[model samples]
Target: MKKVKRRAMSVLAIILCLMIGVSVFTYRFFSQGSQWVNFTANKHIYSNGVLIGGAIYDRDGNPLVHTVDGVRKYSDNESVRCATMHIVGDKKSNIATSLQKVYADELMGYNTINGTYSVSGTGNSVYTTLDADICAAAYEQLKGKKGTICIYNYKTGEVICLVSTPTYDPENPPVISADDDNYDGVYINRALSSRFTPGSVYKLVTAAAAIDNIDDIFEQTFTCHKTEVINGQKIICSGTHYEENFEKSLNNSCNIAFGNISRQLGWNTTAEYAQKLGITTAHELSGIPVVKGSIATSGGDNELSWTGIGQNTDLVNPFAMMRVVGIIANHGMCVEPYLVEKVTNSSGFRTQLPPNKTEKRYLSQSTADTLSDMMRSNVRNKYGESNYPAGMEFCAKTGTAELDGSQVSHSWFVGFSRNEKYPYAFVSFVQNGGSGAKVAGVAVTRVMTAVKEKVDSQSTAN
Candidate 1:
């Protein structure tokens, strides 16, 4: 009787272990089943690790890339193909952030129940919110320059134009040598993947912080003798502006005045405002993660002053900066940017993505309005409105980020359109480009013109 009882106990333990094992397996299958099915090694969706099926289309139904009889094909227009290579991806899956790699499971029509079993031989279709023509125009403007251009709707959160430089045509890829300086970081998308020194464009954050914290910020006045000393360190100005008020100081990009303001705000408050403005945040656009900008507050008064003027250890992502401008344009609230608009499966079923326009307020409406007026003054009084398309209502700030060891400063132009019909925010970065207003401003003008034309044409057609 004792032996039988011991045998029953052993059987019960074994049964309990098996049940627990099955439950864990079931949970993992449900949680991570898509990853398993979409693995590059899967024979159904991949051919030697290259995605075998699916089509990618732009907003205008222009085919950016599609698979024909198990072979991938790109757009016929060479310029368009090269311009969108970073977004559509290459054959080897080198661009990790490409929609092709990020949305592979959906492109392959993978579902927990069907698992590509019901997918047609041609696979699925991913319709993006990108405008191919605008991308092409921006790419042309970026020729021979290593940088990026991004423009998205502040109201709708649709990324209409996103073009990264140093991209090669997928059909005729170049042999990039590691020692070549021109092809450095060719695979990386600067708009979404890289960070740059914010330069004077960071003044917007400083201004926002001061607007909310300092009651007499606008009424403050300072004199620029081309330099100012803070904590035994010299803050140099580009030019002597004599005596100036707060708005005039911003218009002149007076470093001396900003350095003084920085000393007043202190490192802690500056870092706090940077975080609140989304400079230190990592945002995802349809599963494609944007690299976060960074700031360091552990520094002396001199370093703090530099940080306030977008120097020191401050670095910003172009996408995030563009989104910041969008927040200002949308009156304190931002419509989170997104790329993938919808997906259609092989079985003729279409799934439209929900709008990511959350009503999260990043700034007070009053602050945004004040910033908008100031940015408009920047374009009208400083950058020259005649440089942009007529009636663009362009509000912008240009930054020339000084680099280490005599490298030309990076050129940055970040702004938005106040026109109700074209509520777009844009960022243009030119690596090693001198003078943001002259170098990056030219690119912004050309690209925004193209964007305006596209918008006008669409309105007419509708």
Candidate 2:
């Protein structure tokens, strides 16, 4: 009887151990499933070097990407293929299209029940907020330049146009292994991943800092000699901007005026506002790798002044710039950007993928109003005047950040439109692109026009 009791106890212990082992294995599988799915070679969904996913479509129900004859294919149009290539991604597995790899399971329509052993039928479909035509238009504005252009609705945070230039056709992807002549950073999504120097456009940060910290920020005026000496360090302006007020100084892109403002406000004050505006902060956008923006605040008066005017070690992501502008258009509310609008499984069940908000206040309504007034005047009086349509209203800022040991600067243009029919905020950045107002701003103008036209046509049809 004693021997029988010992046998029962041994069986119970063995069962308990098996249960614990299964629990641990289940935990690891559920938590790090994407990592395991990264190895696409053994996946049954992909055959003959083609992704057998359901499909990826634009917001307008236009098919940007789909599988045909068991092979992944893009739209027949070359421009469309190039425009949405980085966003929808290519079949080639490389470092640039990590977003594609991350969503490989979903693309294969991997299901917990039916897909436990194999992903049967076509994968789930991913429908994004991107407009393929608008994406192509934005890409054309890049004009073979290395840049990123992104636009989203301020009201809903729906990203309409996200294009990265120097892109390649998804159908004929370049070889990554050998010394392929066609490989030209085609897979890199510069809009979300690249970090570039944001020059004068960074003045928006300094201006916001001043507006928030300084009691009489608007009343203060500044004088410049094309260079100002502070703490034995010289701060240089592009040209002499003499006795300029806050509004005129910004419109003129006066370096001396902003340098002085930085000295007065100091690094602490500037950093405070910069954080609020998403500078130097990392944002976790779903399924996309977004680089963080940073400010150099450890230097003396000279460095502080230079940093104030959007120079002296200032690095910003184009996406961050877009969200900052979105905050202004969103009336001081934080706007988290999102791409995929919905995902439909093979069973015909659909799940909406709207942006998740942090409920964090980026700017006060009064401050946004004040800044909007300055930016509104900026569009009318500055470089933006001639580029936009006549009688159309918008607010924008241009940044011409000088690169390290380079003659040309990283040009940046950020803005939001005031049209009730088309409320969009956009950011355009061109690497080594001369003049923020000229090179980058031109692209912004074209993209905004395309979006406006799209809205008008849709409204007319409705």
The per-candidate count of clashes, in order, stands at 0, 5
Q: Write the per-residue lDDT of candidate 2 for residues 1-462, one digit (tens) a residue.
A: 999999999999999999999999898877765555445555665555445666888988788877777767778778888888887777665545444565666666664444423234666778788888898898889857888899988877788988888777777765465555344565678888778778888898888888888888789888988887888878888988788889999888899999888989988888888887987787766667688888986788889988888888888888998998888877788757878777877665673354464444688998887787888889888765767854447789988888777468888889888664677889998888888888898888987887788777888999
Model 2 bad stretches (over 4 Å)? 1-24, 32-38, 48-50, 95-99, 116-120, 175-184, 352-360
Clashing pairs in 1: none
- Compared with the true structure, model 1 gives a TM-score of 0.94
The local distance difference test score of each candidate is: 0.88, 0.79
lDDT for each residue of candidate 1 in 1-462, tens digit (9 for 90 to 100): 999999999999999999999999999888999889878888877887888888999999999999876678899898899889999998879998998888887787777777776445777899999999989999999888999999999988999889999898998888888899888898899999999998999999998988888889888888889977777778888899988988888899889888888888988899898899889999888789999999878788888888989988899999999999999999999888889888987766784455555657999999998999999999889878888888779999999998899799999999988997888999999999989998888898898998888879888999
- Judge candidate 1 against the unseen true structure and give its global Cα lDDT, from 0 to 1: 0.88
Q: What residue runs in model 1 are displaced by over 4 Å at the alpha carbon?
A: 1-21
Candidate 2 — worst ten consecutive residues by lDDT sum?
Answer: 111-120
RMSD of each: 2.0, 2.9
